[model samples]
Target: MSTSPQKRKADDLDIELDLDEYVPYVPIKQRREAKFQKLASQRNIPEPQKENEPDDETEELVRAGPKANISLIDQAVEVKKQKLIEDSSKTDIEKKLEEEKAIMEAVAQRKLLASVQELAKGIIYTEPMKTTWRPPRHIRERAQADHDAIRQRYHILVEGEDTPPPIKHFRDMKFPSAILKYLKYKGIHRPTPIQVQGLPVVLAGRDMIGIAFTGSGKTLAFSLPLVMFALEEECKFPLIRGEGPIGMIVCPSRELARQTYEGISSMIDFLVRDGYPKLRHLLCIGGISMSDQQNVLSEGIHIVVATPGRLMDMLEKKKFNLDLCKYLCLDEADRMIDMGFEDDVRNIMSYFTSQRQTLLYSATMPKKIQDFARSALVKPVIVNVGRAGAANLDVIQEVEYVKQEAKIVYLLECLQKTPPPVLIFAENKNDVDDIHEYLLVKGVEAVAIHGGKSQEEREFAIRAFKEYKKDVLVASDVASKGLDFPDIQHVINYDMPKEIENYVHRIGRTGRSGKTGVATTFINMNCSEQILLDLKHLLREAKQRVPPVLEALEDPTEKFKDLSGGCMFCGGLGHRISECPKLDAQRRQQLGNISRGGGGAERGGGEY
Candidate 1:
């Protein structure tokens, strides 16, 4: 075998190959695994374990390692378990929040469905509105002159398309016998100008914008028709519990609401006693128990007389719904809007699911209110009696330049000028209280009323004054707007109101119900020149003597004649829109709101 070198090399290679085959050879993977095990063992590191294995097993594995002091794997497993628990808790919290949100959404949807169902039921009882009532052709032709004469005699100015002719007497409307008798008992022998025209439009079921002087029977004009409408509905389909309020009257003040409530209640009582179906009405105003109002609503209501604030609150709270309400009257609507109830009014209207008969009665018709009326009413009849914002012709307005300090003393003398049953209007509640106390101390039986008084207190004071138990009623503007005191002989302005419109309303309190009365206004240097200038123009327009102080004041209206022809918005002669304090304040408010990241500033701007 060792003879040749090449042959020997070949034989050696063959032998080596055979040896390799026979030898117990380790694979590369096995070799690496062994090497890693050796390295881990030397370093005191434990082998990796499966996630599904028990923590005890992992700890055992770590402990089994030679020279291993602590189990890092066990610590890691414990940390993972804590993280899992934290993750589960977070998931549960999120799930709870989502469930709550879903529940709220479901509740809201259910309420909406319930409202819709109720509205459907309401619509079932609704009757088609009659917008016109024309007499027979022969009668219309024959009585045309008679109608014209009636309108002229009452100073009735009507505007609208296809408006019904004015009715001369209550019987012409063909009211229920009970209502006729009640009116007669109340000494309402004839319809006033507003009643003459307003009755026809309302009975025809047409929307109306009624403008008349204060105490001109506007309340009766609207209330009587409302009662009739409600009665017809009740007779046709009686209301179940929580089913009604077919008619609603919204006033601006609590006193006004109470008055309207009493007025309607009197008529309703008369009708009920005469064997008509019972018609339930509610008086909803602040300073009264909400539970009491809710209780009334639960039984079912046919009519509701309320102020904007409380009415809006009740509607929002779902105490009662306006689904069945078809007739709506807004008494002293301008005052309501002026007192910041416009938004509330609009919100309340949103609850009406169907078209309604809307009546807006006011002593004044500013352009702003006119625009609102246009948007709110559909094809409404506008009945204007005399000039808007004009002083009552029957009022003897006496303007005096009384110093501020002397006003209190002068008030006593003014009281002596007129007999008992005098109304004194002051701008501030504090002033009203002071004047009332002063008059009482001077042996004058006086009572005070303001927004600050409780509902009971205000009612008592108004009642005492109306009954002539109190000689004078010292009140803030709350009593001036639409409160009716039957025989108020005099109205004394303790202080001139900042706005001329208020002055007009203040004087309007006395000269009411076709009776002559006197209004004494006290102005001083503290009074605004703009108001003074407005007073001057109003005096001249009314044919009253204008004091030299007011007459001498420059009329800024001439400067604005080229721009706007005067302050058309508020009917002021001393200012344009540029100088309008109301507009300026509104703009400032809008800007402030915008700066605070509020939207809809443009909406407010467009209102101007």
Candidate 2:
């Protein structure tokens, strides 16, 4: 054991090393010693040298390898071998990353042209959508019956796909079948309209603009594609972790950001259940503690869900890095801009390279949003489920002029029979509160949500409204754009919106899910002619009937419901004279005949 030259030959070569491909900081002299150590380790040299030997192998693995400074030729040759081994590992990491970058290059470049090229893809409801010409009652029923049959047949025959183009390079990807099996188990055997179309373009690293109404599966559309890329590349991110952005998903509000995070978590759970277990993500939003989010980042995370302001705040604090990001998504893009987040968006995006894939989605895109999109996202695929003019065309439009004083009674009248769950919009916080209180006192299930509410309260209100604990949600404009209430069957403009665009958001809440919705605006007598003019213009743009009567009413006031008058029978304010105890019996007796529709009454129920 003392020293057989033959026995010592292999021991002389064993070494240990670990390397990263991107770092070029490793020096040259000690590289030979690394080679010898690697050779010895590979040959399993025994512990004759192990007793007092330092654990240099474990200590030096992440940094410069053993023999990093050794200059002797014999050790250098061993070190050279170690360096080669380290370099090879680095080379493998580099080669794999390069192939990913290369494979993704075409996708990245396509993003350069995606916006214009993808604008026309999902044109499901164009002029033809408007060609129904208000089918007659019988014809409508018959048409609906026919369509229902077709839809049911289609649902059964196909898994709601549009001949999904097979994934390119499917064999090259090392997908965990258990994940696929899990999806299959859940009958998610096929992707939805948005997913089937958006995934390929995203996987190719192209930017996309997703436009679909609520519940059309927009969340899964982008999330699945993101997962696909992360899994295929085994994306490096530190969660609770390391430094650098692997991905960022920006939503308009904390509510939406949290929703997206929860969804991604479930997807990860699903994948894990099927045998492919390792998946990591993060959630960042306005109300959450920055330190908590930063700690998660310290560990490194693969996916992050955040709103623009909070994400930017974290970015400024150096809690997250966007320079290394390969993917970026903007959910409810239009709403984000409306919330005055343009500056923050550009600031957060500035940290990302131009080569990153950017996916932006909204229910509707205005010119303002489009202009911002111009500077924000690269040429992105615009997957519009419906365009500006055609948005919510499936929804029906209605308007009713009511006296300011009679509004409550009229609302109660409207609600008396067959009341539908409604979204009532008001111009101010005061209005939201007043209207909300009235509804609650009237025994209607209702909740109020606005900027004044705490984040927790706001979230609770939203959940309560969604779960039907409340059938109506009285809110200010804050609830308009970012919300998606697919079951809202009616939207009432409790107060005529000051801006016409606000009216659009108000009514857009209803008539979701391709269901015909009813929106009634209580055009008060006080609304200015210009306000009326604006309403007309917007209605024209939306291509719906603007009530010939509303146009005809001058200084424009004809109350739709005449519920505010004195009790006509008795001529008592807010009550019938017969019901008023203040009246003398003789007076009551004298007016009794007239009040009861026996003497002074006119025909057709318009008597006084």
Candidate 3:
């Protein structure tokens, strides 16, 4: 070690440093406490500690209170234990009484729910109620005489027990001031024949089947009542989100639905402006966004005018419910069945949770269809203004024999017979387009609508024609059913419809709202003899001039003397029940369906 300074330093540095033998540094106080604990444990003696010494964290928690440390699990456990102890302490009789009390509460709750449901469903009568209020005997007799005179004057035929007397004017309807004002604004001073009777029956909440000529205020007859009913319902209990349609109107075509929706909307708008509660309505039909309809449904609705197909689709998807629906209208019911929508209508009805006031309106109502409609109603009143399937007396029908090739050329000359607002109806879509194009080429302002066109196009065309922007509106049969075209001076049948009921509907487009109109029909050899015979009889019945071509045809009623006026099944004078083309077609369709393992065909019962 004393040899040299360098040798000494080298010897000190050369000593091996083992990493495994290394230890982390510790404070002196902690090391001493650990050493004392280890020594006490080895000697089997307890180590002394300061009494009542609280750590900082523990002290803070104690200051916070006992609740601070209790976990949710512990609290739940405590509650459960307390409940169990209370339950165990109960006597057998007491437990039985508690159980009985729970059952009674449940029963009471169920009964309350049922009553609420009944209130929401509104009221529908099962049968017509007799008039309880009476005037003096002489006054009653005079009133009866007056009613009979009115009925006879209007050709009003009513079939029901204890039917209400028809009102003489709109003022007799007892409508709200706003409604009366609306009617006055629309230039309606008096009620039409259908409205005279229909208003009373519908306002009374009786089920009814109304058969009147087209364009005879049938829409108002049903729509006004629906408005009143919906108003009453909304006043009683306002519709919540996703709830609605206290009243519904089902049409066979989209155009009709839209028209109805717009009409109701106008009335509603007027009422709302007059300080009435808002009544929301929706138009449910094809060629519209389902999302838009769903959005409207989410906001709730009070009334809905819809076509069968779209309505069925919405019902199937559970977009909205008819739980609150108590008023239903089937406009053009015969046409609906003819279009094979009877099943859809029935299916829609199935969605209703309770009985509803059902109304069936049409220009024609065959007996079979009436019976079928009656099955769904509870003692419905049959109100017929004039004979079923009878042409509108307001319409002057003109029949001409035109060659198929020359019909297009004859159309221009016919349009000249009427003013700017003329309706030309073709049986098919292509013919409508051809007519439209031809008129346009001849520098005539014309618009055309058919099922083949988009909804936007059809609406635009209808709007243009209605506003008098277009002088002529060439359309297919789609425009015939339940479409109210105002000021239509003339209706030209470019092609005769296959069915006579359709012919009546087509002509009905012109003669509307107590206004006289001219209907010019073109018939060629392509038309069936059955239609010709029916047309001849319809012409004769309406006291119109009969074309020589149709007049030359032998009247089938002559051969079947026992068959009385017309085919009782279809109201067609051309054929008896045994020879009815409609029946024969239905039978053939039925056979074909059976052979194909499908359901039977549902045919329209001829015009009412």
Candidate 4:
């Protein structure tokens, strides 16, 4: 087939093919073979084969070639054998048998070598190594205690008639063997608290609102249910494009949508290999060709992970239908609401049946999110892993009351001190770009991402940052939420965010997956008062040291000593201005001058 541009040109040129003649149309394969043979003949590569070679000609050649030379007959025989070996008519079973024989031979040779080594070492036999080790009784007891403490600490509220029990281990749950194998392959032995608690609620097909910190495995908590549901349907019926997708994941941003897609896609491949129905998924985001997305939708998909805007676009374009969607997940719902995607999300949800199982996952649940959940979900089990606005306990927060002009200096000092892979978040795109350029000028490997950047540039920046090709990533709030970036050692707030919740999200970028990380914020009195108060409270909750300025801002009464009159010079408000010693020397000098001037300029020394 011609390329699209070529086809368009042909259409514009009014080209037509005439099929009236009896000229036999040649297959593309035969035409290409003929063309290549002509080229080979030109190059004198054994003169090309003729199209109409008589069968009797080969017999005549065999009878006469022996008279010419005996080696020619041997050559012909060898060529015939090679042609037979290369024949396309070979059965798949024959190929499989050959591969199996080769593999068995290799295994036997390895075994023989190992046995020879054992004999040379004078060893009679060897026992297999133990690959599994159970935790000691004390360790289990401690872990149980910790789990109980965690459950007690977090305000995990559930309202359901029959809630499934929390799983102690992934193996204890009745997940498919494929999922279990994937877990083992990923070396995820222990489940996070959110997973332990939320998995059962979701697997039971209950509407759930899971509030967990970033990188706490909430993706898996919700994704596993979608995957399991798809798997269950796979055993019952074949899922085709005509049926639309079985699961739909909506995230606020394209990066987050891609992250969720990747998380679910990994399991899809494994499940398909483990005898499940072939699963197909598509990422629906803007900043790409709509025609390409429409093409994919025409082919059908089993799962659609998309940002809200692009999904709405596709829905309006009639690219795909959601009638068959059984699982609906809204990841980072709070962020979606914050980014003003609530209407889009609501509109998209309207396309699906109200009976579809809904799962909303967010890091924090403000009143807006709570109301959104109530309106969209049905009796969702509100699972709060920690305090709603609390920063991750794994992050060590440091605050400095730096002047606005000196922020860059402080940032540079921090970059010099901290390890690589630092993330610097700014409040706006201009700041992000400025910091990125400044870092580059200073020879720091830095990349930037923001709404101002093109989609390709943003993707490249994200990729570079993730791969450590760039050590520092300067970004606006776009990178602060939902995106799963790993091994970020430090997060520096070059400019304090306007919202307290955003502060939590920015620092939450680091200190993820139970890893300890550092977050440094350059704050000044010029920052918003509400953010200052919120930062103080958050720092106190996280058990970090609060600066005196922040503490004073948090509680003005405690820092207040006296509000009475003070020395005008020092402005201490601790002494009267008249008795202030700062004026004594000036008064003495004035009196001496007046005396020397014969009292003509005698000063009124009452207040002097």
Give the per-residue lDDT digits (tens) of candidate 1, residues 242-335: 8879989998788888899999989998899889998889988888886766666778899999988778787888878888998889888776
**lDDT accuracy of residue 521 in candidate 1:** 91
Could you tell me how far off, in angstroms, the CA of residue 3 lies in candidate 2 after the best superposition?
99
Model 2 alpha-carbon drift over 4 Å, by segment: 1-196, 212-216, 235-240, 290-295, 335-339, 416-420, 526-544, 549-608
Q: What does candidate 4's lDDT look like per residue over 1-608, in tens digits? A: 65798779877566434443338889997898888889878886433345576566555465445454457667789789877878657665455446545533442231221123333555432221111123334434555456455566544545444444555677656677888878877767788988877987777677777888766888889887777776666667766556678788887676777778888878977887788776777888877665666654666677888877778777887777877787788787665543235445556765764257778787766533454455445556777787555678999999988898898867889986568999999998788888988999999999999887888898899989888899999988878877777698899999787666678889988888889898999988678665576577678768899889876763432232232212222222222233333235445755777778754223221000
Residue 70 miss distance in model 1 (angstroms): 86
Worst 10 residues of 1 by lDDT: 106-115
User: What lDDT score goes with residue 190 in model 1?
Assistant: 89
lDDT of each: 0.78, 0.58, 0.79, 0.69
lDDT of 3 at 246: 88
Residue 227 shift from truth in candidate 3, angstroms: 0.6
Q: Which clashing pairs does model 3 show?
A: 364-608, 365-608, 388-608
Task: Name the TM-score of candidate 2.
Answer: 0.56
- 481, model 3: CA deviation in Å? 0.7
Poorest stretch of ten by lDDT in candidate 2 = 123-132
Model 4 ranges with Cα > 4 A deviation = 1-150, 153-160, 290-296, 554-608
Candidate order by decreasing lDDT: 3, 1, 4, 2
lDDT of 1 at 28: 92
TM-score, one value per model = 0.75, 0.56, 0.75, 0.65
Which has the higher TM-score value, candidate number 2 or candidate number 4? 4
